[model samples]
Target: MVGTQHAARILVASNRGPVSYALGDDGELTSRRGGGGLVSGLSAIGPDAEAVWVCAALSDGDREAVRRGVGEDGVRMIAVERPVFEAAYNGIANSVLWFVHHLLYQTPLEPVFDEDFRGQWASYQAYNAAFADALAQEADRGAAVVVQDYHLSLVPAMLRERRPDLRIGHFTHTPWAPPDYFRLLPDDVAEEVLGGILGADRAGFLTRRWADAFAACCQTLLGATVTTTPAGPEVTWRGRTTRLGVHGLGADGDFLRERAHRPDVAERITALRAETGAGRKLIVRVDRTELSKNIVRGLLAYRQLLTDRPEWRERVVHVAFAYPSRQDLPLYRDYTAEVARLAAAINEEYGTPGWDPVLLKVDDDFARSLAAYRLADVALVNPIRDGMNLVAKEVPVVSDHGVALVLSREAGAHAELGDDAISVNPYDIRATAAALHTALTLPDADRAARTKRLADASTALPPSRWFLEQLRELQG
Candidate 1:
């Protein structure tokens, strides 16, 4: 039974928390916390609704912090065992769901329902159960619970089974694998995944397309009642309604503008300017070194662009910050090494003593990345696939000289930013290279006009409104 407590306690759970920690030389864990859509969205969860973030801890320091509870009010961090996080993050979330969406795996070469896979599935289940148990403990009676991403899909159902009064919402930040692709999972697995999410009062995607895909899964696999309406659609199982909504995420321009003015940012920009010398059109990209990011392909395109068009040789520089991710996995390690190799090759092939064509930084430094955005004349956001590339939205809002964006059609942000961007197919090296060339050479007036449009599109659904819209619709 839904009750008035929906306005009170709210819990946000995901693989990554708003903060991360590291053990210092003094044997004390130091924590770094900051902003993003999730941070801002949960911030708007309001005074009445307490926000407790239960996230998996991957590092020794993270475990220490989790044990010590090093966080601000309303932010509760829980660190699962290292093995659980490894299998859950690498084996299940990235291996299974990521491949399902990007269609990255060759089905013929894929292993299905094998012993190794089943073991990983167990880890995945246990990890999600951890979040569900935490939510059930923290959420007061009738509290509203919002679970984030495919990683924690099972939590909605498990939590609801424990706390029926709780109003739960689940949002998938990746494309829903089509029913055909999803069928690759064992039949029981498929049914359970859909049913788990359906336990929520509301389920959300970034677009109508993703929502429709999810509805199709329910109708075909679960034998559920699926209804289409003007607002969107609904998935019903056992007389309970699970409304599907689209809350397109956005950038906090006002906050970013203020952050950009800090003295450290000014010094970094000055340093970058001095380092780059004169008349270099900067093409910037910031991405985690995940397989789906297609960093190797992006590098191929950059090289092809230089080889095919000699004129752009010394005119441009690509500032790539591929922050390290999932070093626990062999696949991730191999991918990172490949990226480093390509960066070195590109620099060697196209460099003088004074300049390198590609400036690749593996370390995750936000201020430096933001500084890149401010200096960039062309921001290359060619994600092989993304739920929503916040960089697409953030660049336009923070860019000092109104940077032109060369975007990939597969990105979730493409639906919103395509009209204003120089869109490209991430798979096609020549095409992406040409698109980059076009973006780099775009005129000032055109860049400004496109930047204005992109900024407007970026601001369409601010975090507060996005959060509120989901809350209001959940009640209906």
Candidate 2:
């Protein structure tokens, strides 16, 4: 910023940036932080890096707030502005792409990709175009521009056509469904999505399975030459060779340690423990209300446990923090309502005056989540499918008391943490319930050993190192 070359200027285009500008209770504009792998990884880049993240502003107030924030160190925080943002993110990103990647589409008899879908597709394009314009404006020649997730899939091509001199990279943090499932998208949308990504100088996915699926799509659909390996893919497009690599993301152990001991978090943990009563063992889960979370099944599993092993009912609690995600999407709203109904049913059947069966929270509070992590005796993470579920790794490393994990085989973390968990199929409520019972009843020595193993694996890579690894590939 002070007359130095800042490495050509790093530009990041995503659906939402790390910080959100909203009105605080005191009538002052306040900036709230973002959780998840992105915030940690981007923060690692620090202020000196030539980075400017451009994301959509969800409201008129948010756009005004972002316009003010855009002054920080040449940080061009551009918001694409309303209605389109909601339709693209909640509608196409979550309802369409997310469902496709997780295989969550309701395929009773046939798949639907009709005119309404095409209208939503147009909104998706407009949203991507907004980010593309921002990047092209901020990025210099040879600058590295990294676009994230399914929300901005079209940005790579939109920007590349305008600024071919810049280096672009795309990383998908979710599964890339098999070609058969993926082909359900209309021909025009399918071609544009693939071509947009192929516009990058490099691309990344979590596992080899997802990476291979991407390469196959390019081969079959785009007729591109692709060479694949265990962790990377090579694709040739328009006579330029773009690279692909996999870097398994890890939890920030130090940050967790620091936050876990924060004064506010300690207070929250005390209240939660006291409110739940003295002898209850806590099983904690923090997730957005996504279809792939399998929240309803998890609730059923808990019910099965209370019914099958009634003795544990009086002593165990599932403290679930499920935030509202993609609420504008009817399917997600329906899923949230369904989860609420299930929670109510279980409480009606099992609650006592002193104890509610499930302590459910439907809001976002990162500090409270960390507090729950510290208080957990058992952590439940059972995603039906995931690119990588970091909760399985993070909870073990951050918990103040050592904790056993009940994990699903479908989670990408299963490959690393399976040895330390009581593994179960996410679909099988009976088996998951049995596993939960077993975890709570695990002997102290066995629990301690498994907890130690899980903790060790959880912090294997820090966020700074994760981002550096990806850039190392790009630089080389």
Candidate 3:
């Protein structure tokens, strides 16, 4: 959607790029394009639009490619030393920023910020500086640079210092912790984060609640002046005013439909269809095994449903795909093991020779996930807190037979889909179980109507338009 002349001036900086290269047995590097909102947004800009994707080298293959100067034509990758990258990525970005934003750390004993954390914090800054330098070097004069997610939160401020003529925008794809919880971060680090983000002309969040949370952090922590206006929330610090904007990134309906119809997806659908017996309803949940996903609670709620509503037993199947994530972190590994353990216990308790109560798959398969979306009768997305649970939006848009959504009130998707979904408190297993029962029993007519409305709202702003809208705001 970018204008022809302006397209060349647009640059996207993020932790990962649209494409990655892998070396094959024959010694040829193969390029593979990624999927998801970020990739879709970049692709929507049109192939001829002279855009560049700046990203960090994630794998040894990527680093080798960087060394060989063999990258996807449009991507510029920054390859830091392995130790530095690991500490910056796992130690700070994932362990600290991700946990803080999601409020996952327990206040009683965790997040010990000692000498070790300070060392990692320095690496985090160096890692961010690498990105800032890459983006600044590649971007054209007066370019519009959009930095994404918590990984590169410092890039906006760093890039601003080097390229003042460029229009900079930073978007957070995670929930912003409230002021009190955010104060858990060391005072200096918290202030630095606020100052880094405020360096941009515009700071964007997935929901207004999160945007307000960021504004409150600036006011309380930095003692910065905050003012609300029709334009947007403005934070003034040391004479510079940065606007805060909310943009809920929506599902790409056309892309999902097209991909859902692929041959591999059809094959997966046939395999899943065999698992789903006749006369049984399907309950589908797809998620990465992230701590904030509350996967264990969702499993507990499903178990509760079977216990409380025994009539639905053997009449319904819970198809959950918990793709592995952050396995390097001990906490995530233990959490994943717990998820497997719970699913096993549930199967042992209620599964029959003819019908298994739960079918849990931990492998990553996009085609299988899409197949589940198409056939889901009920879609469960009960994250404790989420920026925007795209699975909540994706299921409604792709459901062949209408799906009843059991959504979490804390999810950003609830802002748009709450009216249609059976909402529940994420912490209440009983309430979630009740909502699941309500979703499964809803009349087909009402379910269809609600699904239609949800599909409309979820697809309200496709990736192309979402990117363009934010670009317009930053440019303004």
Candidate 4:
């Protein structure tokens, strides 16, 4: 039975929380805070507000914590049955929603929606229902509930049915698929996902383009009526109107600056500075080897730049940090291998006795990434699609020498920083190569000026303020 407590509380539901725990050999539980915009934003909300972070247990440590019954910092950890969790998280959310929105899958040979997919869809629902039940159990009467990302799309509707008094908001940290692509989901699932989101009092996207795409999907698929308002886009369906909003998540400048100056970062900077050599311009890109990240394409573009412009042969070095991501998935593993192979080919094609043209590292090192960001003369972030690529924002904020950004038009960051960045079509190898050249050659004064504006835009809604703003809007 759901009881309505009169006190208002802030409830944040996401696939992962601000902190994760580790179990040591001594059976002691150690905790560390996680990074990202959400964690920053939640930390910014200040200490006065009563809040609870609801997250899923993704690892053995997390499962242990869940079984023991609470996250380190009072977060509620839910452990759905393993098979169900994997099918929902890996099957539907990552495979279906992520691919459809990013336009990653090869439509002809993939996306076979068979009995296996149907079973996964059922698991996805069960996963979401588990979250909804947990959230409903925790939320106070008339509490402000903010759900995060595609992993929990169905939670809004499920929770709304249980707690109508709660002010619900859903924020997508990824691009919403256009109606045609979104309809690729079985008709019933498509309707339910849209209907689930529409159950919220407010649904927020990283950009107006994404918000509009979502509204279009609702209009086309569910025949929901959408109207423009000063507040934002409003969708009315089945006598309930859900307000849509464009809320871009930005970098935490204060935190980054402090972290960038740490001892580890200082050591990394000295090491990278030597690797870059003297008098050579450094073009850097730090990305996990996610298919949507377009790491291989970015490497190819760099190769094309070397091929087309011979003068830059020994003068520029492309320092690429291609960290591994989702290695459990065959597609991701293959993509990472391809990134490595292409990078090696570039080195073989362009390496001189003194200069290795492409220095590619697959290790995950935050200090090294920041060191590269500071040294970057040109920062390349060419993703096929992104909710908001924070690297695009973080580089400008930390660059010691003014860094010119070569951004992907497909990234959500483009809406905020594209005017200053040399924008390129993610699919156009030649165009991306050209943009990199332009970024590398921009006047120092121009680069500095753009860096300032870009930094301002990137930090406009720092984590704490971004979270608080949503809470205000939902309550208002």
lDDT of each: 0.82, 0.81, 0.90, 0.89
In terms of lDDT, the best-performing candidate is 3
- Residue-level lDDT of model 2, residues 315-366, one tens digit each, is 9888988999878677779999999999888889999998888989998988
**Candidate 4: misplaced stretches above 4 Å?**
1-8
Clashing pairs in 1: none
* Reference-based TM-score of each model: 0.92, 0.91, 0.96, 0.97
- Of 2 and 3, the candidate ranking higher by lDDT: 3
Determine which window of 10 residues in candidate 3 has minimal summed lDDT.
1-10
13-112: candidate 1 lDDT, tens digit per residue:
7878787889998997787885666677777765555667666676788788767756656665667777877888788888887778766777787846
RMSD of 4: 2.0
Error of 4 at 281 (Å): 0.6
Residue 57 accuracy (lDDT) in model 1: 73
lDDT of 2 at 445: 87
Cα-based RMSD of the predictions, in order?
3.2, 2.9, 2.7, 2.0
Q: Against the hidden true structure, what lDDT does model 2 obtain?
A: 0.81
Tens-place lDDT per residue, model 3, 1-476, is 11122234778888887767787887777777787766777677778767778888887678778888776656788898888889999999999999999989987899999999999999999999998887778777888889999998899999999888889999999999999999999999998899999989999999999999999999999999999999989999978889999899999999899999999999998899798787689999999999999999999999999999999989999999999999999999999999999999999999999989999999999999999999999999999999998999999998998999999999999999999999999999999999999999999999999999999999998777788888889887
- Give the true-structure RMSD of model 2: 2.9
